[model samples]
Target: MAGIGPLTQDWEPVVIRKKAPTAAAKKDEKAVNAARRMGADIDTIKKFNAATNKAASSSTSLNTKKLDDETENLTHERVPTELKKNIMQARMNKKLTQGQLAQMINEKPQIIQEYESGKAIPNQQIIVKLERALGVKLRGKK
Candidate 1:
């Protein structure tokens, strides 16, 4: 309802669908039918379906996943103390101020300061960004 468009248009008319498959899709359908006729079993069909669905879904999922992985703390976990020490040491070794390091990693200076002061532990992704920006390994690396 709140979008840049004609405010009163019926959505049904806006939704147009192709009744025919594209050439590539039609070729794929023929190949699948041929495989079926050649005695492709249920397991083979299932594998093909799974692979195709995964391929189709992955592209749309990438951007969403990138955003989620960057921002979401999936386990509600914090950076460990050892990692905090490493972050602070790394930032100091890099000869960068907290604000400068924050700018390098696209974070708030408060965030860098918090990590350095060990007052608040950052999320895993932020730890990774800091590690990369500061050229130091923080946590979970062998």
Candidate 2:
């Protein structure tokens, strides 16, 4: 009562106490104690843990066998040299540059370049688009 006035009052700061151990932590501690009572070597467990951590650290290493398999799976039949020549000739006859032809077909110029250079994998949809744009047979029997 003496610490309070019309415009003043006393306040105590809050104290934070340490939390009690969680159930999982208590269970792990009990297991460790039981293992010690059973004469299980703590040193061997420590060594095994260290070995596991070391193996995990080195697990980022690349497996070249899997990489080779992936690359092999990615292999595709490239556009034929004759097809490349025909595309170039047709584009030249139409007076359309690679960029222009790509624009006409709504494709990136790199696609046209890839087709002309014989490095493109044959896709039926793109081939059909190119045929319609260039008015030429680019695939199968011509």
Candidate 3:
């Protein structure tokens, strides 16, 4: 007992609270409550929520699948000669010079020319960007 020091007392638990909702969230809640009071049906709200959730889930799944497929297919796939010709023709039809089309696709004009002339095969990323910019499909099954 003489060698023993003072015993430490147990500490009380501390509770932390989160901050109140922001003004924007409060305003949104008020608007939603007003809409509900104005006879917006509960069933309609439920359906809208369900649809939004479904769309978000589906989009996430689709993007994940697309990314996985792209990663698995990184090996250079040959492009058809006809597709190259068609891509060139489409660019010409849009009255866009090679440089302009390259700018639109965020690529160099020489790369575009090489792709069109079948001198070089483009990576999948470039192909996707070109498809989006040109509004045409340049790659096919290999």
Candidate 4:
């Protein structure tokens, strides 16, 4: 008893209260209420809110489309063999090297090589330019 210290007691429970709204928040709420009372139509606000919600939801969604192998292969179509043959024969008849033909057509030499090898992706503009430069009917009916 002589060596014992003062006993500690539990404190009384204190009531907790939610924080009051800030001045700005109260002003904004008053303004919205006043606008509603003054017959301000909420349709525009509703539309804007709906649009934002829709855009947000769509942005978070992932594109999960399945691609077909055959369609994927067909998408990157190359120049036809007949077209390649015509380009090569025309170039030879014109006595112009690949570089010379490319320069004459205002294109790169690699482009000319790709066209002749049938590995190039067909471009109507490039074909037209080649036809004009070489005076050969490379593409079209027969």
Best by TM-score: 2
Q: Residues 76-142, candidate 2, lDDT per residue (tens digit)?
A: 8999888898889989989999999999999999999999998898888888899999999976676
Per-residue CA lDDT of model 1 for 1-142, tens digit only, reads: 6777865955665667877757997888788888889988633343455545677777889988888779645664455688778887887788889899999999899998888667774687887788788777787672
Stretches off by above 4 angstroms in model 3 are: 1-78
Off by over 4 Å in 2: 1-47, 50-52, 55-77
Any residue pairs clashing in model 4, and if so which? none
Better of 1 and 3 by lDDT: 3
Candidate 2 local accuracy as lDDT?
Answer: 0.85
Ordering by lDDT: 4, 2, 3, 1
**1-142: candidate 3 lDDT, tens digit per residue:** 7999999997999899998868997887788888899988643233465545677788899998988778554556565688678778879878999999999988899988888887776577887887788787766642
Q: Score each candidate by Cα lDDT.
A: 0.77, 0.85, 0.79, 0.86
- Which sections of candidate 1 miss by over 4 Å? 1-78
Ranking by TM-score: 2, 4, 1, 3
TM-score of each: 0.42, 0.54, 0.41, 0.50
Q: In model 1, what lDDT does residue 121 have?
A: 49
Candidate 1 clashing pairs, residues 3+ apart or interchain: none
